[model samples]
Target: MRSGFDCASFRVRCLHADRGGRLSAVERQVERLPEELVNKIQAGEVVERPASVVKELVENALDAGARSVHVDIEGGGAGLVRVRDDGRGMSRADTELALERHATSKLRTLDDLQAIATHGFRGEALPSIAAVSELVLRTREGETEAGTEIAVSHGRRLHLRDVGHPRGTTVEVRDLFGAVPARRKFLRAASTEAGHVAEAVTLLSLARPQTGFFLRSGGRRLIEAPPADGLAARLFQLFGDRLLEDLVPVEGGADWAAVRGFVSRPDRPRPSRPSLRLFVNRRPVRDRALAKAVSQAFRAVGGGDRGFEAFLFVEVPPHVVDVNVHPAKTEVRFADGRTVWAAVERAVRQALGEGVRELPRVEVAAGRGEATGVAGRAAAAVGTFLDRGSGEASGSEIEWGGAAGPPDRVAEAEGAAPGVEAPVPVILGQHRLTYIVASDGDELVLVDQHTAHERVRFERLLDRAGRHAVRSQGLITPLVLELPPELRPVLADHGETLRELGFDVEGFGGGSTRLSAVPAILGQKDPGPALERILRDLADREEAGWAVAGTRDRLAATLACHSAVRAGQALNRESMSAIVRDLLQTAHPTLCPHGRPTVVRVPREEVSRWFGRTGWRRS
Candidate 1:
């Protein structure tokens, strides 16, 4: 008497098929029951606190393939968090099951946990979200274009109807922990909670290197990590151009996993390890054991407390690590993380030994591109970085001053072709990067290697970024960097500062960043060298708290000295003149970013005395 097939047949099949499948019927029964119990279960996993809810919902959007996710929170995660994504939307029934515990399309069995690849494998995120907070999810799917809204409070689902929603999902949570007053009492200060929320946002944004992210709290935008095309592009977009300089490429794999990130040079260490970022399959993890191995290897390569920064990507078979280890997968347990550690150590060591880490950036002496005796050793140190990708094609030779990474280089290789005059003066009458230039004046001028050049460029771009939008050129090739857990925090804390200086700071996948665009001046050098040098510079600057204005000035002096250009480099005629002109246009051009006088013009008499043409004249 019954039809050949039944509508409920498909869902019923799952009851006997597997564990996750078996739970589907139970979940449906639970959803039909009083909504209170249902919401409470949902709240258990999603709204533990402000950051927890933020993390869950954000992950939901990310898993849905959101390219640009926006999070707006008020009074931290406690007041409200409205997350909207430009991903595939949900239909009426999809929205209903979405708010139920253990109901998910991401998994079908417990065995799925072993190879969990998506950001949200647990079906609990959305439901857990509706429990504690007044949750509202609005969406539209393919043909169900009118879109519907589902509201749940204290674990009860509201009616759905046509709502003004475009093509994706927009979830809003208000008064988090409103039902659970006890939980409210445990909340931290707004700023502290805001910081946690920011951190959560940063982590998720990093996991999806190509996805764009925006976070705002109390009506103020806290973070904006744009979608990058590739890993290096993402790194440059978020972390800044400094991390790209003098980068050593790391290419190695072991036990079915491959790892890649930048290693800082000996001169590039930072005071802390914040610059050391690491990612596994593009997810940043806090694996102490694995990070320890990196620390050891980094130390072996030489930059002391001033350690380096790397945007590393480690691709492992999904089964090797258990992503289900925690609600927040920030901490990972790889089947063979130790093997990863050893491989990283060896990769870095070999990179340094082969001189792969020091591709044409700071620390190289001032000279024509040809390597001298010492330069040859320096080149050897950076060889690993140079080996992997395309090397600079200029054949112009390495022209570097012992200086910090250019704020400009974090984005792209601005052509050597000079358009706008560079703000900084060059050493020995050179064009900005050309290193030499011609002048129309009677008196010949020598550009100060570092300060003069930086002064003009720094002021120009810093001002430009402030006045208009920050100008970031897309990099044709990206520089990938790898780092450990310890240094990633420091990078997070100081990301705002670096961004002001022209870096695109975001959590690159897990700990790895995909480099994208960069500033124009840095040219084609990778960003790791720049990050390494800045880390060292920051270490010196942070050695003392900005004690006072005087103290700050003193710190600036030190940073300037460390960040300034050093002696010995070749220059082309136009580059030299540009440096001279840029200096004349800037303040304190005579003195560098540090207090050192960039240039000390020698008098004709002094020049003559070297040949015994004249003696000192009486004043």
Candidate 2:
């Protein structure tokens, strides 16, 4: 305390200070990142994996107006990837600038960004690839005497020279992620990576049907397609003639928007929904709204098993579509998603409506022959949906929903001759009180009771509405509730559609709505959430120019789902029979409106083999 500068005073004097005040202990330092590091970071966004590399290169090839594109790969593209294209190539100056960041010929100003037609407008693809791998670009302009070659590695230009070459472009990428060991370590095995590369090639080839595409992996050709006349021809070239059998053509449009594609018949099903490929403006995109529209169309056609196969191409005005939403350009934003959805759904439905009458019926017949298996006694024990009469089968048609009856008597009710034509499956016993097992001639059909009933009610409700407006039941007491601000626009937009679906909802002062009536089909269901769901759906895409007519069907589906019978509940044998009869009368009897298979037919011979009954000759 006696010195001129004490310890406390010295400590206070040693503290650092900004012009305004003393610096904090944990202040962060900031500076411009190195160019190499910046490029690497940006590359991470564009080039996610080997398949990403393939996507960018192919898109560039397309943007260059390539008529034929060849993709060659090795070691799942981790070893080598090459794309050769016969297109309008670039000159020496363009080749040099292409490796530079943000240098693109596709865009000039703000107007181009708003209406981007070309695929690789971002110009980040080549530079991004250059940053991660050893890249060599050899390009020759159409009228140039010679070509320009540029070699780059890890974002550094190694060499540039002139060479004699054809009027085209070839880009080769090797040692991908060699400089970045962390990214390389994440690469999958060669085969797995190769599958992704093949898929990417397939998608691009499908998008550009008129362009020839050839893809090879490990020197083995994976896909090859010649130029196609149209989308249908391309599908045939890609998927083969077998796919054509299951597909139905769908085409529809509004003033400036249109949708055209093929949807598989409800009967021909796959294990999953991957087969549903949707393209927007000639570019393949995985969009939820478009996919949902296709699915809804399938459900309307009664697809209640596995999902369906569909290829829908939606064409909208370039200005109305935004392709800049994602770096990959696979995802897009539409100005009026609801209009597009409505157009697609209507197209699919119209196609199905026209072809439903021509659809072939499912049939499994046992060839007429002596009981060579030597187990004729077991035939009667094993029930079938088809009752083959000796001369004429009796007890085939059962009076379902009347009263409990003997199984033999029920079979006799649906009497028919055991001939080429199979009778309706005789309702057998209910299994687990859920499935209705029925026997036709040589097959056993298992019917999901709940989903089947739901389909029935759904189709019936739709038919009722199509003929006349859905009836509304007035609520005893009007339910008043608060509405979200987003839902307000929905009310304004789809008020007529909601009323068409049997909902009477109106604004009840500030941010609240009063629900006075509900769809009579809903019965005792709470209309609150149903109405809210409709509103939320409507609000999700407000600018969709057209009033969403599908809103009625969606609500109808909800009502049907709620009203459908539950499993584990006991249903009389006659009631089960009635359900089956009603189901068969509907448009798509095999599946429910939700695309779940309501009925599955197991062949009699296959069942026999399961029980160790063999020695039967092939039919």
Candidate 3:
């Protein structure tokens, strides 16, 4: 036991100990680097991300007024990013002047940042990117046979070299972040880098509907939007066939002048509004007012809960909006933010009212019975969801199935959890070959036709997997996944994660992914696309800030969920039963990792109430 005075003394002593006057001073060290070193440092920021380099080159191409933009990248642009456009090329004077800091063909006065209309008006972009990487720019006039090539690295102009190039400008950046190893280490694997690069290209394409675009990574074509008349056609390639039918054309104007394009499908929305690409005057912008208006408009059409992929373009006069707010050139300041907001919301409201085309529901083969595999979870809860049968829809069969259930019983199962507080699965009257289920009282549980089967499949799979814990099923023929080279390290770091998920990933000599074994649950599925989907999901998750990969077992569970049977699969009763039993035994039987309700429930009492009756009063 210490006295209060002693405790006070102890506290005072600790603060006094940290007092700088009581500590000894160390000698100071300072040094100055040459001018050359400073330029290289500046270059590092301009070309920090792969997208940054691409933006710089593309801006030059756009500012040059290229109708067609072709971007080719390797390793997600980490290895190399090349942008070629059919625009006015640089002359000897232009090439040399372009490399100089603050040299520009766009801005004269600092105030010009106010009415900036070009895709990019920043004069710093070119020199900044040039200072950090091995940059080569070759340009030629349309009629010229020979072109001038200028090479730069770390801000120093390599001796001017003459080269033959097409009648346009081609800018190539290789070995990004090479000068700064710290930044290089931050880059994701090449494949992921390529995906980001692809996203950048998509943004650019959306902004310039008139530009003919061709994009490829690792020699594989990502997009080929070759001068299409409408944004719908472009979206069809990036998203899917859904946008074509769901897109609602918006045509309206406010005092500031506005043109809007929005997609209105309630079923397909992302979790964030960042997905909404809003542009002003051919420049992609992330405006709070515009985005809020779009959100409100969407909420009006379909409640606030769901998300829709929207591409809304709003064009204001150059004088009305200021584009020079940020160096990245993403945000904007409209003359009247509220006016722009009102116009954007009005346009979307009118468009949603106009209505888009809806496709008829086509039932395909989905498991209604026992979903005993990885994809069978949701299917087990309800019943087989709608499935697509052999169709000429796209020369492939689309299977759809309903939740294997008489949807009402899911409520009873959910209720049993709070009252009983045990592992027992409360069964409701089973009909339509489905188990309507809810778990932990509140959260919904849904079983897919395939996942129901997967539970059973994995049970059998694990039983077989017990002895060695290393089951390698060699494919008849190995499948190859072409990825950008930047992602090479991520694969190397998470090798065990791949193996545990039933992916026998072997590194092909070059920067490529070779699959020898795939998860057993994917039954006869093409391993290439499956792996890519999983990888894409992983990459997307990385963006969402969930990067703690602690244990292989947990990671395996994640991959298993990803590779498991989906709800939209087909199954029979036997498979569904195995899945139901397995889920009941599993510790986490309530929700998927993503927090989506596995299934929703409607109790018998609730169903009776709908019929103007009550379950509590039995008369």
Tell me, by TM-score, which candidate is best. 3
Higher-scoring candidate on TM-score, 2 or 3: 3
Candidate 2 Cα deviation (angstroms), residue 124 = 0.4
Query: Estimated TM-score per prediction?
Result: 0.52, 0.54, 0.62
Off by over 4 Å in 3: 1-45, 142-146, 267-274, 356-536, 544-619
Error (Å) of candidate 3 at residue 586 is 4.3
Poorest lDDT segment (10 consecutive residues) of candidate 1: 1-10
lDDT on C-alpha atoms for all candidate structures: 0.56, 0.65, 0.57
Give candidate 1's error at residue 310 in angstroms. 3.7
- Model 1 — TM-score against the truth? 0.52
Per-residue lDDT tens digits for candidate 1, residues 459-535, read 55545656655455555666565532223434554556555444554556544544554443333354554554454
Ranked candidates (lDDT, high to low): 2, 3, 1
Clashes per candidate (backbone, < 3 Å): 115, 32, 86
Q: Considering every candidate listed, which one attains the maximal lDDT?
A: 2
Better of 1 and 3 by TM-score: 3
**Per-residue C-alpha lDDT of model 3 across residues 222-300, encoded as one tens digit per residue:** 6667776777766654554534555667888577768667656543322322357777777776776666777787667
Shift of residue 3 alpha carbon in model 2, Å: 53
